[model samples]
Target chain A: MEHSSTVAGNPVHDNHGGTKEIWRTFWILLGLTIVELVLGYIMIGVESTGGRLGLKGAIIILMLAKAFYIVAYFMHLKGEIRNLVMTILVPLSLLLWAIIAFLYEGHSYRNNRNTYDAYTRERSNIQSTDKKADEKGMHEKKRTGAETME
Target chain B: METTTAGLDTKWWNGGKSPFNVEYGKLMMWYFLMSDSFTFGAFLIAYGTVRFSSNGWPDPNAVFKSYPGASETTNAPLVFVSIMTFILIVSSVTMVLAVHAGHERNKKKVATNLIWTIIGGLAFLGCQAWEWNHLHHEGAWWGSNPFANSDGTESTDNFTNFFFTITGFHGFHVLSGVVINIVMLVMTLLGTFEKKGHYLMIEKAGLYWHFVDLVWVFVFTCFYLL
Candidate 1:
């Protein structure tokens, strides 16, 4: 079977290689995932919030790297025309602001709740005290009733 | 090899050809995937917002400890989920191979790879179903969280709410991808692309499958790992 080099007068680059690059990418992705899993295991032992945040930062970086590999190589976006790449990426940059704003708002919400919402503050305090009594089983039953009010 | 003077001129937007140099269908597929990423981004970001606002959250390690056929008291963490993650990654590899085979115009290889990809999708979904059932049995649902926070305080239902919603959405995507692959496989057997002289359809389907895998990478990191 013969095929044309262009579809609808648009040139399609013929960059096909036998499974070499595919296997290479597969290995890279697998290795990255293993590293992530190892880090997650280590995180179980880390108690400090700062330390856990740092490890989580590392995991997020690894996750982005994996995403880059999949989109660039597996999806073949890297081999595409520059115009196409830019169009897709430029719009996605908007997510940066969205993430920052939303998380900031959430933090402020938590702060507000802790400050002004006496009912929630009291409830949480009571729950923690109940936890100290080793009455978790009993508290669990009572919490079901509490949840209905909310 | 046939480059017209206009093609050499770098006037990509001059009106006659695709500026991206890709066919209309594939270009549209790229844009579609781009928009789909935003939808997923909104969901994960929403999840993060809720997590940030909550006073306490459940530890994923404690909740997702048990695996299939393990005793009820098993304490394994990140084990079964790691298996699910690998299944997705391997399926994504097969999808890449299938796309490559389509480029080579090899019918049998494409069919074989697609079948492997489908099996991988189903396996991942099966693992998810079992996990959900186990969690449900433990009194976790949209509005109920039986697991306490890592600090031993009561946790809000948002944890399980986002968990089930995001993962369920992702699982739905996988199911649809599997259905699409089955359709592509049948079309390949019938020599539809062979008659059409191009396997561009397979390439588009491959893009969707990889997108599903990509989304899982984020979901797994957000919910399971961190």
Candidate 2:
């Protein structure tokens, strides 16, 4: 509907050859997508269950492969300028690295909280025992297994 | 007989082919789509990272659902999305045919294919509407400030926030696709593209339609399948 026949900006092409090549590219993309779906499902499923396949690693690999195919074939990035691909990939890589860092930090924070809770409980128990002995109005020595053995 | 030249002509990339045809709008659209893909890709990647980091994320079969009226259990599975996937794929096929007809200079076939494509787009939108309402009514929203349930109970956890935002964005795109298809259909009826003897508009629109389908495939994998 927006056609203009000025031919000022028209890309000259041997339409027959170009069309055939593009069609072939389409078929190849379709085939790759099907393969990806099948393999990706098996990989993700096995990984989700903590199986031998190292699910997370496998998923990351397959996901990258899928992204590569889509960008190269469907998005025509394969034939595009080098700078264009870098423009897309650099930020993506940085974002992924940031996510990994944040996740690890969060995990460590949870672990620290657990450790603190354990130590606090141990100290409270010792204090409570000492207080109970003091309430009896006797100089009750601390129950030491080593003293008993001696 | 024709005379032969002693020398050959040389040109830039695509070898003297059109350098970014403005009228075709193909190159411009490609650039736009590349940027758009990055946007969606970032969302999906962030989702993956969050899901990976989180402890005890819900399983797809256990979480996302088909309605009880449609299925037999609380875990109705991704059957609704599966149907929507098929509809979108079918629409893509019709769109391809429309583009083909445009190349062939077949106006009647172009119109028919456009109509079919529009119908498919509308069907997808309807399905999305249903899925969204179903999810909302099922308390899929983020809970209270402490992220607790309204009744002082613990609800499903916070990863659902990412789920709703990403998928909701995609659904909004689908809604717009429907509107765009309607506009294209109306333009077709007005004979705007009829005299061109080529369905350039359909070709451009197919790029868009296919991109949407392509994005969904990734979303399906990232959100539901994984």
Candidate 3:
């Protein structure tokens, strides 16, 4: 019994030759990574002092770009069998959304703590200042009583 | 004689080929890799959430760098990891070349490319081991930061927790890939792949080798550079 298929007729397998696009994808991935590193340094190190957009945004954007390359090329989900790509992506998208929701909640919780601290500080300051003013008035009254008696 | 006799009569076993009509063995490997991709994706997503929650998190460079002198403040900027990333990408190129060699039925060239890949894999693992060993902490408690509140309290950021876990897991995968390549190289030397009458094993191994490199690209971005 022969273990191998003859070279002439194997209908199940196709010899899809390499295309220019494959090399193009490789170079693009490499170039994009370099761009990502440069942007990361600039955003995190240089612009840390003063920037409306911070390192977080830069990180997220670069990550998404790299993820796009991986999913498109390495994973071959880009030129996949039609249903396969959707099956992979839909669940992944849901996962991303869940992560986003959790992140937002964490941010909200931190912000809430900051707000609470500020409110408490302001309230304490007002109470302390008011008490000091009342003590000053009482001291003046005691002094005036002594002066009037003398 | 017994093994050869046993090999003679099975209708289901087509040497190494699949009996299942649904998919070829190569395609099955692809499916397994896809499932593994989802596992890695979950790790990355969790990593993202931790990073997002940590307000004003230290840069990877700042966190990983070792200051030579007390006055020296600037941290090393992921230089080691960048080199490691380049090495991995080059190995991926070599892996694809090996697959190309396999398709051409040039066993010597396939062996050479696979050796290069194995070398690159080992080099990557060595760098990771060094990086792991170099990690040092100032505080008695591992998570404590130098910057403390007026009450001398530090917020538990848990950055290092994710750092070790994610990178450790990825490192394990890399190690496994290296072992797999070593096995493939041995099989090539033994002419197992040749007698098996298929170059598809090389193709599958190449796919896996490439996937390992691909995963590192993201890990390098998420864990080191970004």
Candidate 4:
């Protein structure tokens, strides 16, 4: 990210107070983004499912932190009145609740779908075998032997 | 304005006026933004659900890996997206600077910062357009994702659908934000706010711009990082 600093070695703060804070946030956000990229890149190399899951969790945590910084700093919500802050934050938690519920629901469907597919495949296999047996002159001795024995 | 003798006994739910000093326009902006946030939040949640249900997802790194002057085979993940992220973050910086300038009544600095922000917004949109086009030719389309389907079929996986919808919605917001910034720039140059002796307009616009950036933060996480 580009910072309007006077020098690379100088402190981020300039004579202007607010401008300094903005640049500091700019750098922090940039660094976090880079860390996210690095973690994501490393996950590409993780072959184990458990390792990949752990990395995904870590990435999500980092992402949430970055989100907090962006909203609090960039959007200036940190300095807002407590009432205004709660007005936005209180209802937002419902969104997180919705997300978890839907994910669980979707996972349930995934499990059901596997069994459904297997059942359909088994039924089709049995039908095809029956069709082949009927196509041939095969009933073993069922038809004639039953009638003669009777 | 009618003087209300009703005193503090007035019902808290009375809609006559805002009890707090927050302006009507600013308050309305918040309400509108909350609704917008809800929409984006739902889109993201939908994505997460699908992501959870699927056994394997296309790695965002492998899918969105492109950089300026990068080789055709270069697989560095998120290089282009990082640039996009920086563009947005810088734009937010410029936006806040513009707002600060407005507060100080520094017309020159306000105009300068606003122009820089407008430039950033335009550049970000251009990058998105290029990315969409590039991905389109690479077998990623609104209907299908090349990575999502094993047989390279179209219209099967929901990945491309969510991807296109979410990003397209965000791109629309960016495009509108650029337009709004341009108008504000022109108005500033024309001394509209100067004649009025206040630049509250710029501050409000800055709020919307910042909100747009906030939404991008989530989108970046969902689409690029996660």
TM-score per candidate: 0.90, 0.65, 0.70, 0.79
Error of 4 at A7 (Å): 41
Number of the predicted model whose TM-score against the real structure is largest: 1
DockQ of each: 0.44, 0.04, 0.08, 0.16
Highest lDDT model number: 1
True contacts kept of 3: 0.11
Report clash pairs, candidate 1.
none
Question: Candidate 4, overall lDDT?
Answer: 0.73
TM-score of 1: 0.90
For candidate 2 chain B, which ten residues in a row score worst on lDDT? Answer: B144-153
Comparing 1 with 3 on DockQ, the higher-scoring candidate is: 1
> iRMS of each prediction in angstroms?
4.6, 15.3, 14.6, 15.3
lDDT of 2 by residue, B67-134 (tens): 53664234445556666766766676677666666667577777787788888888887887777555
Candidate 4 docks with a DockQ of: 0.16
* Chain A TM-score compared with the true chain A, each model in order: 0.77, 0.48, 0.56, 0.67
lDDT of 3 at A121: 35
Arrange candidates by DockQ, highest first: which order? 1, 4, 3, 2
lDDT of 4 by residue, A13-112 (tens): 1224487777888888888878888887887778787997887788788778877887777666676656777887898889889988999987876666
Q: In angstroms, how far off is B16's CA in candidate 3?
A: 21
Arrange candidates, best lDDT first: 1, 4, 3, 2
